[model samples]
Target: MNSSSPIASLTKHLWSMMYYFVRTYIWLSLIMGISITFLMAHLVFWYLDSEQLERFVSSASQTSQQLHSNLVTIFTHSNNTCSEQNLITMREDLWRAPLIKDVVHIQDGRIICSASWGNLEAGLVLPKPTIVWPERGLQHWRAVKDPIKGDIQVNMVSDGAVAVLIVPDNAYASIPSNYPNTGFILSTEDNRYVFHASGPMAPENVLTQSGSSWRLLLTQQCNTSSKALECVTAYNAAPGLFGKGLWFISVVGVLSLAISALLHSSILFVIHQKKSLKRALRRAIATQEISVLFQPKVCLTSGRTIGIETLARWHDKHFGHISPDIFVAIAEKNGLMPQLSRLVIEKALYQASSLLKTDSNLHLSINLSMSDMSDPSLLSFINDHCSGHRIPAHQLIFEITENSASGFEGIESSVARFTSCGYQISLDDFGTGYANLSWLSKIKATEIKVDRSFTQMIGDQDPYNRNTLSAIFQLLKDLNISTVFEGIETQEQAEYILRHIPHATGQGWLFAKAMPIQEVARFINTPNSSIQHNADAAR
Candidate 1:
């Protein structure tokens, strides 16, 4: 069967579809894995943070109790009066304590003494000053506004006396505020009386002390829940869950990528082995079990077949139809490129012999390799074959791939000799490599085939140059060098090339993909091949 057989194309299309499906699944799995990892990380961090806050509240509770014990010892030992020498000593002792503001004593519901103010003179009425506070425990906490300094005092009272602690705002130094956007709200468990209230909107999450009357709230330092959770988990989370989640995710991703790559490689290996590419290639060449196909290159202005590019095809027993590139690669690796090239050239010349005789203007294009060119007897071999087939050298244009044309040192001289002997040389796949302008200046071929990349850009505005191929064609015209646009797969691509370079030739699926040699006459029978400007220029 020919390389252009419908079955071969259908197989490639099916493989492409399957590849897309598998690629999409792989991407989805990758993304899902990452998301799950991060979510789990945040959850872990939040739990740790919550636990840390509970411990902080517990510390606050212990501190409150210690203050309670100190107040109890001081009140009962001084005969409950300001004049006691011990009472004066107690006041002196606590006066400079950081947590204490003042200590006051009451006798029979009358204001009797204040530690800092001494005895009340002229019988200042006490009137049982209001003490409404949260009932966290048997002890009482009262908040009273200070008039002059405009600060508040929180009083911790026992059965006998009241101990005034410094204002919460001034005393917050005892609690840590090290975390970002996160602070603690120091208040009673019920929140009825706030010792140091975390400002409004401070705590978005809360935790209570396990064995105490205090509540600790995590404030709004964290904007998102993830950040908040991370902050909480990081509170006392020194040397904690910081890098554990990332490490787990990295291992998962690396293992997945490795496994996926291995799986794909194994599948491709199976495909390659089942087809037995090396063996099939040898069999195909030995028995000439291959078909020759030709894709017509039409003149843009005339819409007539000016030339046809030769292609070879082989149908495998197991893999159905394989791509030409695969077999060609196998041939090169096995050191059979010379034999393969010679066989294809001979077949193309023989199969198209009658067509060449019928149309004097038509030429056939055949790709040549570096090995074929480097062979000293290659020119003679081709001439002998052409002479036997009665085909003129001018009618067969040898196509040299850009890469093959560049590396060979004496290639330019050899190619020049071929042209001098009535044969034409073409630089295939032009503008797709480093050899475009550099090799063009050095080697100088009769024709340049603009590679598919440039053809694909036809009728499209150049992202960089803007003028793009339009400018290129104008330069070609000035240089009087013929141009052939390759890989014009759509009618729009065809129209774009024709409209811009009407004198040039084009070969692509639009005009005619490669077809069996037998189908050549059928296409050529109609001189006007119904090519029109109907297709929009490709953008």
Candidate 2:
């Protein structure tokens, strides 16, 4: 190339400057513009697809739940087998139901009185229940080649006792045909009570999610392939989930904005929520606004406080007693949990140390989140607090929710160190949220806190629930893991648990609601004062 003249050199420099500007600013702008456009397009696409998926899952789940409920109710209400007249009436009533093809009451694995069978068949084998919850009733049961209808039918065993309500295969056959591509698979495999009844595609084609009674399955092709996409998108089935897919877009629109306003306006009316919350939380930490509440864990037989679960309570001046659930969730989501948890530990340790000084038998329980365990310095941090406060580690129980058990999968060895160091591990909310033997076996758990749902279902007449609950408690007992029945609000419940487990630990309103540090100290001071008098159930 030839050497440039002075003017040519100036022109080249200007061109280079333009290129630099384009590279640094213009190109970046172009990339951002493209990214935003793609994002908007993706959001639109997602909104459409999600609408159909939501419809399929929602309708299928609702239909399944209604059918199961009807089955259970009919069988449970029927006392000592249905009479011939009652059987005819039941079949007639069931046929009127939206998806009821047939109904039946089986005795000893044989169908005796079926909705379609007037005289009743001799022997009709029913498929086992597709899903069975631990203490909840059996559901989504299927029977193949019915002795009466000739078509395949599904059954729901009302605790498999006085009845087995049979539903026709066609009950779940077509998804209205009005709503297309969107279909589902309901199953009870692996303890999941799912419901699947034809249409859409093979069971393997769809993805699944488990809820109370059924698992909602949806395929990736729901959006594009279905001709009834519009109808499906327009339809709403699940409770409180109408047009939920269009929420973000609807935020700027009519119907949803008002509803959104109604929902958010009530909760968000607190002034300067986001920034104020962060500041309030941070200030609360600095000022030690976190007060510890001790809920007594009493022995079922002895009715004495054996352990106290340490709960952190924050009542912000501006917010005025924000729920622990809300505040804690906020702290975790915002990455303030570690600091909040640390503050909680320090306060608990200081107080627990004082308590230990007086009574050596008392154990202080502290709840731990996954993040708290993930801290590389957590063990050391805990050790420092224990050593610095002169409190024995055994007196402190680190309660982890069952949901968090799997989250600490790789850290089991790390957690084993905590347990080995005399810290007791108790799985909290035992029956809630996918708490199974698999996760139970993974952690070094010493105690299981059975959730309130099972405790609430305890009654003299509820044989199905009673037997199921007994079996669950017995299984835990066989595992050699101590049990603590949580949310015991009545003497009846407390007595029932003790009758079964005898020495099992009991927590919740029945003993004492979580009390302030001062109240707890007073309660500990006067152990024989009768917890009933000391407990203010209003809390």
Candidate 3:
């Protein structure tokens, strides 16, 4: 009887725990299921809305580029500036360019003549523009009230020769009838000026307000061209999971509650299944998942793109974006550096072959690790690849880090061999690692890249840091070695480099970020845009 009683008590205890567990699980599942269903519905609507916005922005960008191209054509054909014949030509262009409402001749910050208003007696003095892009030689005004047409405002863009006028509302008048709550706004890259806006949301509200009810996607449009602007497309959230009936919601809620019991176990399984870095990297190399990007180097005095440095980039489905430093270190440790370097070189040269052929002066730079310099096969591989691509050896600059140069034995001879083969060598990241000055004297480098650590010290109040920078700059100048000031991210840094090293080139985000191959082509296409010329002229 005592043994039976103990068994009964143990069974009751187990039953109670199971009952509580089941009850809790059921409640949690019900709650999570409802939440998930609502989230899924919202995602569906958001996806649809984003697609619509993407199409709209793309169309607008094409239209803007077309208009700018036509305007450039008008400027090219009309040799005379603001003359009677030029005015006639402008009027004719206005008729041909459907997007352009009118054409105005601007000189010395004043409207001298126009297609609509033939000529002004003394020229109507104009106010300052809302935004200016010195690099592209472009300026724009968001709202200009017409003197003759009472209360009508027009948008204007000029290249210091002729201005093209556009009716702001006409640009965004194609909003679909179904998307009643959809809103659009076009602004400068810096968001300083609103070029156009439409729908229920005002430009001011769209820019200033941050609300979950409105989902906004901002895209930088026409950034690589003269016609540069940013587009913002908004969609107001639909109420209650896009109007799913109560019955549907209830059913989904019940099903989710039932399935919630297995969710924890499934998540655990997924977590354990994630691949290690080595395994993933090996797979990436095998699948050719690595990509190459280009960072432009601009002449400090002219702000013209002079060269581009190739950068290896990788994105794994599970790992997202991996930094080069991490991947490179892992590759070296795993005896995969050679393979990785070859992959990067192959892709970069292939992608840049056309651009290199077009511009002989535009050099393509590739970075090499210490191991790469040590490998005998590397030089031959690169030479063969260059020959295949028809790229000149002199057009390729091999960039080696300071550590790589100092750590590697017989690096000088390696560099000399490369130079003898007509390739230029650059000592990159000049100020970091071991602080050795012997490598500078030993290696015959064509160029030296001042590290960003030094660039960051431009505005330092400490006299010691300032003097160190001065000495470094003076040393490079004394060596007569071509120098590239890396990480110049601000106007101050650029100005400082310009003041100290007038002949030096710069590479950084202030001019442009590292972009894809296509953007590089577009950026190099316009040599006369003169970012620094306008700045100098303004001064």
Best by TM-score: 1
Candidate no. 3 TM-score: 0.48
Task: Give me the overall lDDT of model 3.
Answer: 0.75
In the range 381-465, model 2's lDDT, one tens digit per residue, is: 8999899988988898888753444565655775687888899887778777856566577776888888888988887468898
Of 1 and 2, the candidate ranking higher by TM-score: 1
Give all TM-scores, in the order shown. 0.55, 0.49, 0.48
- The order of the candidates by lDDT, greatest first, is 3, 2, 1
Candidate no. 1 TM-score: 0.55
- Models ranked on TM-score: 1, 2, 3
Evaluate model 2: give its lDDT.
0.64
Give me the runs in candidate 3 sitting further than 4 Å from their true place.
Answer: 1-275, 402-407, 434-436, 527-530, 533-539
For model 2, the superposed segments whose C-alpha errors exceed 4 Å read: 1-275, 402-408, 460-464, 525-539
* Cα-lDDT of candidate 1: 0.64
TM-score for candidate 2, please give it. Answer: 0.49
Tell me which residue pairs clash in candidate 1. 49-232, 49-233, 181-221, 202-219, 202-220
Steric collisions counted per model: 5, 8, 1
